[model samples]
Target: MIDEEYAKLLKQAELDYEDNKKFIMVLKKIRAKSLDREFNMLHDKAFEEIDCLKCGNCCRTVRPIYQQKDITKLAKRFHCRPIVWEKEYTDVDEDNDRIAKTVPCPFIAEDNYCIYYEDKPKFCRDYPYTDKTRLRNYLRETMENSKICPAVYLMINWLKESVNRGTLS
Candidate 1:
C-alpha cells in the first residue's frame, strides 16, 4: 500500500506549483547540469517507497496520445485494421493530436493492470518520464506528473530541497 503521507505531499506540491514557476529556473539548471545521477537517486528512492499496483493513477486518469505507429501496432495486437481501430478507439484532441477514447484508459483491467501491458504504446511505457537520462528536458512533464504519481511527488520534493541546500549545485 502507498503511504498516505506521500499522497498528501503530492497534493501539497500540486497546490504549491499550480500558480507558481519559482522553481522552474532552478529545475532547468539542475537538469542542465546533467544531474541525472542525483535525479536517478531520488527517482529510485521514490519508487522504492511507492508501489504502482496500489496506485495506477496515471492509467486511471491520463489518455495516451497515440502516434501513427502506436495506432498501427495496437491494431495489429487486436487483429484489426488500423483504420477500424482508429475509428473506434481514438479521437483528435484540441491540439489535433490523436488520443485514446477512454479516460481511465480502456485497457486497464479491474485490478489496475494494463490489459495491453505487453503491447502498450511507448507513451504508456514512458508514463511520468522521470528516469530518462537528461531529466531536465522533461521538467515540465515531470511537474505535471508529480500531482498524479507519488514517486514523482517524492522525487520533486527531494530535488527542491537538494537545490535549496546547494547539495545539487
Candidate 2:
C-alpha cells in the first residue's frame, strides 16, 4: 500500500544509484561552505513538498543508532530502567554501535507518526543530516540516504539541475 510517489522514489533511487555516487564526487569538489548553504536551502525546499508521514521509508528501512541518553529517555517513558530498555529494544551492530533491534522503527506507529517523536534518538531526529554543516564530511552518507529518502532524492536532483544550469559551481 505504498503511495505512488514513494513507489516512484524507490524506482528512481534504484536507477540513479551510479549517478548519485558521481554526484557525491562532484559535490566533493565544491567549497564546503557553498555546498552546505545550497544543501540547506534545497533541504528546506524539498521538505515543503515532501510529507514524511506519507512516506516513512527511512523509518522502515534504517535503524536508528541509540545513545545512552536516548535509552534513558525512552526507558523513563516506558517506566523501565535504561538497562531494561536497551536490552529489550536495541542490539549492538557489527560496528559495535547500539542500534534499534527492529526496522520500521518501534517508535513509528502505523500511520507513520513517531510514537515518541519528542524523545526520539538524536540520530532519528537528524535523519538525513542534509541541513547540518560540514557538508563534505556527510557526502557519502547523504549519497546513500538519497535512495531511501525522497526529500534527499529531490534535493540531490535539484542540486544536480542547479549544477547543470551553471547556477551552482
Candidate 3:
C-alpha cells in the first residue's frame, strides 16, 4: 500500500504526464540542441540530494525493457536458457517490447537494493535517461519515467521552469 502523500504525488504526476509529453514535443521543435546539457545539469542536481534507496518507486512501478543481451546474461545467471528465462520472467507489451513480467521487479529486494544490481539490464543501469546524451531523443521515455522517479519528476519540473525563465534556452 502507498502512503497518502506519495499516492497524491503519483496522482499529480499522472495528471502531468500528457502535458509533459506535449511539452517535450514543443521542446524538440525549438530547443533540441541544448537539451542535453540542461538535462544533465538537472539530473546531477536532482541525484545529488535524492537517495533512491529511500524511494524505490521506479523498481516498484516501472517495467524495464530487456535487451537481448540482458536476457542471455540473466538467463545464464539463473542457470536457464534465454527462452526459458524470458518465458518465466518477462512479457511482451503492446509495443512488442520485452519487459519485466512483474511490477516491483522480482529482483528488487525489500530494502530497495536490486538483487541483480551488478548484472542488471542496461536500461536499468541507465534509468530515467535524463543525463544521457541527446536528451531530446529520450524525452518521451523521460516523461514516462517522471511518473515513477521523484528525481525525474523534479528534473522535468526544473527543466520546464528553466525554459520558462529562459535559463535553459
All-Cα superposition RMSD per candidate: 2.5, 1.1, 2.5
Candidate 2, run of 10 with poorest lDDT: 1-10
The C-alpha lDDT values of all candidates are 0.79, 0.89, 0.84
* Candidate 3 lDDT tens digits, 1-169: 3444555666788899988888887678656668887888888999885677767788888889999999999999999999999999999999999999999899988888889888999988998788888777777778888888878888888888987898776
lDDT of 1 by residue, 27-90 (tens): 7665454578887788778888887876777887788999998999899998999999999999
lDDT of 3 at 4: 49
TM accuracy, model 3: 0.84
Q: Give residue 1's lDDT in candidate 2 (0 to 100).
A: 33
TM-score of 2: 0.96
Which candidate model has the greater lDDT, 1 or 2?
2
lDDT of 1: 0.79
Stretches off by above 4 angstroms in model 2 are none
State the lDDT of candidate 2 residue by residue for 1-169, as single tens digits. Answer: 3478877987898799788888887888888889999999999999998888888888899999999889999999999999999999999999999999998787788888899989989998998899999989988788899889989999889999988998888
Give TM-scores for every candidate, taking all chains together and pairing residue i with residue i: 0.85, 0.96, 0.84
**Candidate with best TM-score:** 2
Model 2 residue 38 lDDT score = 98
**Residue pairs in clash, model 3:** none
